[model samples]
Target: MPNSPSAKKALRKSQKRRLVNRSNRSALRTNLKKARVAVEGQPSEAADDVKTAMRHLDISAGRGLIHKNKAARLKSRLAKKLNAALTES
Candidate 1:
């Protein structure tokens, strides 16, 4: 419980931010999953999926929702997988 008025307002703002961040993170995960699936199931569409996922990651990182290094690592891993799949096909 927040004792001061300012504290209460801060708590309220944090709750709202939490909800928004959760939604954004969920969408990011969904996009990553789609990219992974496309990599494994359809090489032709993998590039576009990867692009979408990377864009989302960049946006999330820019907004401070995710770390920039984390986003870069994820992008690297996904690109590696995509390349491997493409080469194998």
Candidate 2:
């Protein structure tokens, strides 16, 4: 339905960007899951897992795969979990 060449190219670029963003989001979810599980099971590694999750979140936010506020909220939650783990230990 793109009448102009620029419109066609834009559509193609958007599609490609969407696919890449989806993959990045999936990866971010995976990393977050890993961090949560690590914190739940092995409290000692929670800090490191949290750091890794934060890095992934920052990357996703930078790429526009997720909102910056959402990313910050996730990071905050992870840090809270880490703190709880520390307190429990």
Candidate 3:
């Protein structure tokens, strides 16, 4: 429904960006889930998984895909979970 040529081009560009962003967001979520699972099920590997998840979160925050504060909060929660798991065993 873009009337002008420029508008059409912009729409196309937005669509491409949407797809890329979606993929990145999905990957981030997957990493977070994996980290949570590792923390709960395999404390031995939780540290590495948490590290990878934190790195992904930092990258996503830097790229403006997620808010910096939210990323920090997630990192904090994950760290807490990892620490708790470690302390238990």
Off by over 4 Å in 1: none
lDDT of 2: 0.91
Model 1 TM:
0.97
Judge candidate 2 at residue 4 and give its lDDT: 100
Query: Each candidate's lDDT (Cα)?
Result: 0.97, 0.91, 0.97
Q: Which candidate is the best by TM-score?
A: 1
Q: Please tell me which model should have the higher TM-score, number 1 or number 3.
A: 1
Candidate 2 TM-score, C-alpha based: 0.93
In candidate 2, position 86 carries an lDDT of 81
Error of 3 at 32 (Å): 0.4
Candidate 3 whole-model C-alpha lDDT, 0 to 1 = 0.97
lDDT of 3 by residue, 7-32 (tens): 99999999999999999999999999
Q: Write the per-residue lDDT of candidate 1 for residues 1-89, one digit (tens) a residue.
A: 99999999999999999999999999999999999999999987789999999999999999999999999999999999999999999
- Evaluated at residue 80, the lDDT of candidate 1 is 95
